[model samples]
Target: MRRLATALLGLTLALPLQAEWVFADFEAVSGTPQAKLFPHLESAGRGNLAAGGGQLALVWEDNRDGSPQVYAALRDLGRTGFSAPRRLSTGAEAYEPVVLGLGEGRFLAAFEQDGKVVMRVFSAAAQGPLATLDAAASAQPTLAAGKVGLHAVWGRRDGRFLRLVSAPLTVDGLKPHAGAARAVDTSPAQDEQLYASLVATAGGYALAWEDRRAGHTRLLTATSSDGRKWSEPQPLNEIPRSGTARELGLGRGPGVTRVCLAGDGADTVAAVWMDKRDFLSGYDIYAGVSTDGGAGFGANEKAQDVFGAEKPQWHPAVAVTPHGVVAAWDDPRDDSPDIWLAARAGGKDWSDDFTLDGARGTGSQDNPALLWHGGRLHLAWVHRDEQGGQVRYAQARWE
Candidate 1:
């Protein structure tokens, strides 16, 4: 029996060796910080990196000029490095920048300026502000580009309750659709919704967010054939059924939070989030899949293999690749948080978690943004040392 156990362990260790990720050395995406302070990257659930049309784009907030401003960097796909960071915000305090690739070397960036959401378009030659959304009391804005138009969603505070609002934009001119900005979720005013993630799916868009309507935080999703109309929100996390022995009441189980969604530009969509399901353990990473364009999701599955009393995982980012779905998150199993990733191939279960090469260090690494394009996985995250934080970038190709 001892020999059999040893053989099984060896097989498990050897299984994923052939297809491991070959990662490049991490480089600073924010360039040399002019100030000694940390450059702020967008929050975990929001996108900060995009790749399309042979170009890669990254956006963040910096205070090198004495005030918070939005900045961006572009890199050619065939090149090995990114351009020097360029300021995108004209004035006012700005942060939480999200970027979406518009194909043909064009990109769209949105950030919160002062209190409103400001958007700009970028190309190889020029960049300019596209529009300013009227969401003055909003947070965590996300963007998704589809065949028909661009979709934007954010959490807007209405009096005591927080609502989820969506706005549609024309693809050609990137202008807001007339009267298209409206609340999409039907959660009651007493309940709060936040941390929205939007992804373009086949013939439409899918939106997901963290909800507190069940008396505990949970993840819910909605689908739309057109940007203007949305389907009813559905829960992505599964709750235990009552009436059995040792059953708990509704909303009494572990809660879900900080969800990020990725689609394969078709029917396959994946959602990854931080979950607190184990009473003795800290937060764990959980994921769900939808094959019918987010109209429904399968049972939730654990994405990480490690769980301990105080080791928590956070800021999960997911992407759908030709091989399968891959999820990445910052984990503290090594004292300081480092980026870890897992892959699910075809119909198989998730593979064992592996740390990204060059991501494990003394400092903290968090808020991973993943983009799978041109047969490579591009990743960007915030790295913090004693001095300050800097946005770091690295890419990996499957062996």
Candidate 2:
């Protein structure tokens, strides 16, 4: 028998569900709503997308030996698929590309170029660059703009400690003042570690990263309104099973470190990450939710088991949609990492799990990126092959 929760008026109904988890759709994406310019090749780094009016803006990198270019795939949701991939980089090199759709008719894309955060805005037509922003020591760049102007944040790796810094930019690259970048958190042993996942929240934005401090590997979080100033770093999730406070032995990397912050505004933020306790289990996916804004959070709960035995899951990529919080990750239970998905109606406990098509073998399905739009879940990932790989996508519906 399976236990599940119900969805009611944006609250939990506490109902039991069916025994088995089944998927509704398993078909790959049809066509490209837009088209690509250069010879198409699979991605080497991360591929991310944002949702908008009957469309989506996909951003990825081609970090090859020749030229490293940033590309966008726009799906118009008509009789067409994604038309083609468009190259967005103009010069030198662009890495860690992040894009945000600023409602109305504005699009913001930020990336690292020449060791600086370079921001470019378009008129929503994908015509050309309307303005340029040059930020200092910017990497892992993320951008979001509103009536208050454009906001961007990145990791600053200077000196012994790696710090997270953010700055605000003018609509036309002219700020009334040069905002300062505050060190939200620091690396104590001069270890080269950084926090990567960042997104704009309601009142502000929330970021999650893996850090090694206090003699243990822990997940840390920080929030901010202006991106220049941030809240104190707090441990987002934990399970109590320790020997002693003085000599707690935490595992090494590839642990439950990466996270995704998703919710309605910044009010209901969900922190999803991977964890493995010393008790009796494998890797598990866990999440912590903040319903009353970023003030307080709920208890960290297990989301799924990688081995289908209620434990040992790894490599999760998550997204928040109107339907609920959608999480897609690779499951390495049977020596192979297959794409698995879970959904909650409006962030409640999910009814069941869904496996995806086009993900096969024991090599590497890796990160399964998810998007919920058009009343369906759009999932994409790097499907590994002997020669190389291809970016695959699928759409699934929830009842």
Candidate 3:
């Protein structure tokens, strides 16, 4: 799970003359007549963000009615506030609802409830009925809208083993293609946990996940040109295991990797993970980038500029557009988790680290989700207090 943050507040960070960063006041989006408190009764920051056609959509889990349920809110192109959250699931418990921009004015949302996957199609003004994609055991549902269509993937438990399954859908209604739901990985060992991620590309999509089939977690990726068929599973991280660490003996050991592909006609893809190669400073944010779509990747490098800090830094989230790529994560260098962001524009080096939501000495901030929408940077995260959790959002413009 992404680490927790605390207490909502306003913050601003000055960038170099090349780029000016200004943040709007952080606003609360959860809780309601249904919730007992000002913020939601209980909320989390693992929510997802999507933007299209001058509208932004956010989805997350909210425990407003005495049970965990999936809820969503919408914001118009120039608005600073979000509409009231509308419940999307009827189950008593729903987890990790993810949303994707389906072009025009359509959006797709999916989540896991009672070990099954439930989906819905909605716009800013209207929504469709709940559609149960699968009734069996499933976890970590993810969706991506590409040039071909929308693609969905999840981890399905088959007795003792976990397999990866995917389906292709049309944009308007998310109608699954004929013979679409199929297993992507050819084989895997028993009890290998899997969480899949999908990213949109020019003609198709790219999928990535970490599997323990080889007795250690390795980042794996596959490409598809039409969403129905995928290339063979391939390893993106080629670093040899280093025995310096207790987990691995020779190469880099990746745990819980997250992936994102660039948009706005850019064909770059990046994978960020915590690697135990150094063995002394704890896990670091290492990334692998592919320049030519997902055909291949270059060497892995430390994505963040953690120059002198020795504390654990993880749970990296990235957003990419034609302008640049931005990565943010929770860092403990200040004795408490503070959201930090680093950016790289064009082929230039990454900018020095800058503190986002700087609530130092007051509360901790973590689990940041980034979205490059309408030429601005929109960030959503969870803020926690002695009272409860609150889902808050802020926006930044690069001038």
Could you say which candidate leads in lDDT? 1
Pairs that clash in candidate 3: 5-384, 6-384, 240-251, 241-250, 241-251, 242-249, 242-250, 242-251, 243-249, 243-250
Candidate 3 is scored at a TM of: 0.86
Clashing pairs for model 1 are none
Displacement of the residue 241 alpha carbon in candidate 2, Å: 3.2
TM-score pick, better of 2 and 3: 3
lDDT of 2 by residue, 275-357 (tens): 76533455667777776545456677666633354435666666666656767666655466667666655444653445644
Q: Scored by CA lDDT, what does every candidate get?
A: 0.77, 0.56, 0.67
lDDT of 3 by residue, 1-399 (tens): 111222222233334346445566666666422323222211111228888988888887867767778888888868778888888888868877888787676788888887788788888778887777766787777787766766788777778866778887654364433235778765644545466767777757777777777767777888888766778878876554444554543443544355444444347876666665665777777666677667676777677774424777766777775567777777777666667777777664676666544323345567777777787888776666555666777777765
TM-score, prediction 1: 0.88
> Which portions of model 1 show Cα errors greater than 4 Å?
1-17, 33-35, 171-179, 186-188, 240-253, 307-310
Local accuracy of candidate 1 as per-residue lDDT tens digits, 305-389: 7442357888889998987898988877767888878889877498777665456667888888898889998888888777676
TM-score for each predicted model, relative to the true structure: 0.88, 0.75, 0.86
Model 3 off-target regions past 4 Å? 1-15, 31-47, 171-179, 188-193, 238-243, 247-265, 358-361
Model 1, CA-based lDDT: 0.77
Residue 145 accuracy (lDDT) in model 2: 44
Give lDDT: candidate 2, residue 49: 58
TM-score of 2: 0.75
Candidate 2's C-alpha runs over 4 A off are 1-47, 63-68, 90-93, 104-106, 122-135, 144-150, 170-182, 185-193, 243-255, 278-282, 309-312, 345-352, 360-363
